[model samples]
Target: MDLIRRLFTAALVAGVLSGTAASVVQQATTVPLILEAEKYEVVTPPPATAAPTTTAPAASHAEGHQHGPVREVGEGVPVTLDEAMQRIGLTIAANLIAGVAYALLLAAAILLAGRPVDARRGLVWGMGGFVAVSLAPSFGLAPELPGMAGAELELRQLWWLSAAAGAGVGIAALAFARNRLVIAVAILAAALPHLIGAPHPESAEGAVPAELAARFVTASLGSAALFWAILGSVCGWLMSGVVEPAESRPALRVQPGAR
Candidate 1:
């Protein structure tokens, strides 16, 4: 019994330590957002002119001054640092929320399975949740409507990348933990975003300029999927120790002449 207890404790400790290390590495390696500015031009109105009413005009009354409309001109679009920050913030927030949701779902699954709650099971549940939430949406079973063009387009643009990233991260986590549940979770989580699709574009009439929009969506989804998969795996592994097994029994031994 003591030996078993020690083994369980060691598993919990190792899992947690590994998870923490992975998280630190992830944060350290996160890609930073780069901002670039584009220029644009603004047209100004012409200056106002005043003319004398009389035919002679009183020999050209005192010279009058006229001011033309002030216009600001630039070559392309101009974006400020603040604008870039806001966009990055929105993207980060969205991914964080999605990740949290995935983790919660996994926890619920482990609980539902009636397994002895332990760090390992928690890790499994977490990975499982990531997979289910991320991958389940890809079945083309999602609802459809005529006016949802924008949303549809967004999904097409982002889902593939997201799914791929998620799968990679999931695989990494599984390998690190040596857990089947974790592996499964990684695969599913990586694939989930593509399955669900991103928010559609606003119009079918070229609102986002097809090619650019597609690339953006694909990159965004892929990055998000990978981020969440890694997050789920780490968190799950960290919490694995807390769960207890469902059944407990004493080791059996027989003595001479014992039936």
Candidate 2:
């Protein structure tokens, strides 16, 4: 039993370590591409000029007409590819730590309650954690798309698809592993938000009246929920091996008249 426990712990630790490494590698590869794109062009506005004076009456009349207030579009802060990549890496690391902590807490709770938790249940719990954590940001902030307008914003479709794929993978992994009830519950809990739907920014005040915006918001939320649920499930599964299952006693048979 002690050996088994140690083995499980080792496996969980290894899996988490590998995942962290992979995340680092991914950031390293993508950051350069992003930087190259940003460096391709630099836009500089022309110098300011004084208003030309009109000589003719007709010219004076046209020049004197007042125009509506010009909306001042502020220049956005420039983030180099390396900086963006570093930020992403940091975010991933933070989330990974949080996920692992949550998984450990859940495991401890189940053990304290004298319940036998398996890999499957751990995954479910992970998913639930994902949903719970993601909710605050999803509703509180508006979606922003810099450098994208009209059809270009369709790039969001990729995000949705990726999310769906992640959820599907999580479900499949659980089914294959045949995890326990608790894990199943966690997975479902994590997935509920995506299925329940997200608050649309289009419904918020000051949004443009485009039909796609509403759909985009809804789909994006749904997709993200799915993706995170799967991700959490996988992480939980990896960590589940670390927790020891409660021992079951063998049934005793009494011989006739034996005390």
TM-score of each: 0.39, 0.38
Model 2 agreement with the true structure over 1-259: per-residue lDDT tens digits: 8634643453355335534644554344433333333333234444335986547987656544543233233433468889776878785776456434544544443344343345566556545544444433344332432321223334344434434444544444454445676557646644654565543434333222334344445544453454345444554455443544545545577999998
**For candidate 1, lDDT tens digit of each residue in 86-160?**
855664554445455544444444434444545444455444443444443333223222212335455554664
Best by TM-score: 1
Task: Rate residue 247 of model 1 by lDDT.
Answer: 50
What candidate 2 gets wrong by more than 4 Å, as runs, is: 1-74, 135-247, 251-259
* Candidate 1 wrong stretches, greater than 4 Å: 1-77, 116-131, 135-203, 207-209, 246-259
lDDT comparing candidate 2 with the true structure: 0.46
